[model samples]
Target: MSAQVIAIDAMGGDFGPRSIVQASLACLSATPSLHLTLVGQPSLLEELLSGQSAADRARLTIMPASEVVTMDEKPAQALRGKPDSSMRVALELLRDGKAQACVSAGNTGALMALSRFVLKTLPGIDRPAMVAAIPTQKGYCQLLDLGANVDCSAEHLLQFAVMGSVAAQTLGIARPRVALLNIGTEDIKGNQQVKLAATLLQAARGIHYVGFVEGDGLYRGEADVVVCDGFVGNILLKSSEGLAAMIAARIEALFRKNLASRAVGALALPLMKRLQADLAPARHNGASFLGLQGIVVKSHGSAGVQGFQSAISRALIEIQENLPERLHGRLGDLLS
Candidate 1:
């Protein structure tokens, strides 16, 4: 395969540029043929990498970005005001073919807006939706429209289902089981939009429609791709992350409450860590913007080095798989 290049918004996430810079250096060290272009204040990015060897710096590029869109900035405001923002510049690299993919941990709304404006959407796609992998007992499932479009019609949900199915397919599932996220699994338990979406999915060609899957069913790995509006999907994703953290903390607290428990905890610490790593949200950090003409991934704003690296890894995988091309090719058949 040819060498791969990815552009990163080094100033976008919650953590300072130090963490993003570390992750970028780590990725460069690990992948011999990979190149990174860090879009931010060139001087700060260079200073952060001042200690690196010349070889590492040779493969790295610092693209100057004068402004930054804050994590809480409104999408419209950022779009109108921050033309040279790190997030927008990184995406411009992808749009101009300077890089194969772009990754940003910036404001979700702004990233979505800029990506749509810069990269545009694939033909036949009304809007691009965000899809991220969520851990499941069977393995992992792809959930889409994660905080993209707050309100979606039945047709939009159907489009999300198709895009999500292609995502699963790119991950090597020949025929991914697709399902709609609903309060109840029964046909009669959801709102009209979901019910209508179900009807459309059932009739769509080349999709393995699996009917409705409740929220808990997601953890059970009942479906490979779950479709829902951005409002519900975002809430579900955040709630799941919060719940996992709480459960882990509770377990840790239980073990430290007494001497005997502490002794047992010491014995089980290795196993606990393995389990935690398996289900950690950081392990699946990047969320892809499907239906776009180019590859764009959104990392969690609060992600640390590991999470940010995982986001870059996501962009790598999509680049290798030619994700946007695959989605464009498959949309015609699936929706027809």
Candidate 2:
């Protein structure tokens, strides 16, 4: 029998199960083999699932979960105390071979912590990294260790490169060129971590390490995979988010200024749509917690229906491609 792709942790993210359930239903209609098991309290999921077609009702199954790990809750505290939490339950399904993959938009720290506690890592993986897809002039780029490990060693950075390379290949790149994020393009630049990581990456086999890459060089299509510590990556991700929002707000203000400006807005709408489409976060919704035994996609906390759908769709693609086994074969030695 074919594997089932069900969404666990129904009550996660800002939108919660309303958006999640809606997206899961939409995904079921779009993909036949995809079945949805919304893991949450029956009351909440039943409310969300109301007014749906019999077909959708048939495709979805609700498993009772008593607790939810909130965004503010600490990961360690939640894991120890909240035994029936939705995230934990969802992960258990994956571990027990009942679910092929899981997607969550909850507290990232909690998700990572729970994933580690419940799913554990594949052999030789010291730590798992969060990889998010970012827009670039050359289409898209994947940045790793978004918030998985705040502090990393040289070996961890090299693993990020290997994992990122596999991810880039999955996205259609032949052999993703990796660039260690640093203060300068020089080999000896940046802090001790980058310097040490650069040496290791340059000497590493089966990866294309294109030397050091400065912050400003990221968007210029300098490399397909940008490797850095989680702290730096999180800051970079937030900064780009702020920049995109600021630019969008400025454009909206300009369009409302005057009659001529409004007319100009109409003329510029197509170009704006093109740019928006190119940089839309919803287009790249699935960021894998790399090095896990099975796929665990994390969507943005504020992800709406579209972003949630993209996350589910991406999960399906990853499973269909056997991304985990492929990466293991490629980086097994280095991970060892």
Candidate 2 has its poorest 10 consecutive residues by lDDT at: 275-284
Error of 1 at 55 (Å): 1.3
The true-versus-predicted C-alpha distance at residue 45 of model 1, in Å, is 0.9
RMSD of 1: 1.7
Q: What is the lDDT of candidate 1?
A: 0.88
Clashes of 2: 0
* Residue lDDT tens for model 2, 196-217: 8888887788888898877778
Off by over 4 Å in 2: 267-284
- Tens digit of per-residue lDDT, candidate 1, span 1-336: 789999999998789799989999999999888999999998998889989999878789999999999988999999999899999999999999999999888888999999999999998899999988887889889998888999999999999999999899888988899999999988899999999999999899888999999988988999999999999998987777667667777788889887688878887676655555444443346888999989998877777888889899988989999999989888888776
Give candidates' CA RMSD values in order. Answer: 1.7, 2.0
| TM-score, per-candidate, Cα-based | 0.95, 0.94
Question: What is the Cα-based lDDT of residue 297 in candidate 2?
Answer: 88
